[model samples]
Target: TQLLEQSPQFLSIQEGENLTVYCNSSSVFSSLQWYRQEPGEGPVLLVTVVTGGEVKKLKRLTFQFGDARKDSSLHITAAQPGDTGLYLCAGARDKLVFGAGTILRVKS
Candidate 1:
């Protein structure tokens, strides 16, 4: 079975701080997506990277896909308290494989 591994399993920071999270896999994927989930809520898709080396940004958040399609990263700039949540990465091939997830807590 393929698996996605996320680094820094948990993160805590004061508001306006910056942080970065990573997701990696040994298996190649046709596409990869990032999502964020709050307590008691389903994950909300943040971005999808299909082409190798692709990068996308939403507000203060940035998403990147590795050139080999086996890794990805998410960077948050000046993180705010509202950014606290569980971040997940999913790889799509024959099926979607999800990472363990990174729990982020931003204090105000």
Candidate 2:
């Protein structure tokens, strides 16, 4: 079985702060995905990277996949209070392997 490891289990930041979350695995995946979950809601897919070294940006958020396809990162620029939530990374091959997730709390 493959496993994904996420760093900084929790993050607390003020509005306008920038932060980065990471996900790593010893196994290479065919694809990697990032998701965000709010209270009482299922995780919403944020981005997917299928190619090694791919970088994608969504509004204030940026997603990157490692050249080896074994790691990924999510960076939020000038985070707002509304960005507070749980961030997750999932690696997919025949199945999806998930990271423990990073909980972010952005305060005003």
Q: Over 4 Å off in model 1, which ranges?
A: none
The 0-to-1 C-alpha lDDT of every candidate, in the order given, reads: 0.95, 0.96
- Kindly give the number of clashing pairs for every candidate: 0, 0
lDDT of 2 by residue, 19-85 (tens): 9999999999999999999999999999999999999999999999999999999999999999999
In model 2, the runs with Cα more than 4 Å from the true position are: none
Determine which window of 10 residues in candidate 1 has minimal summed lDDT: 1-10
Give each model a TM-score. 0.97, 0.97
Positional deviation of residue 44's Cα in model 1 after best superposition, in angstroms:
0.9
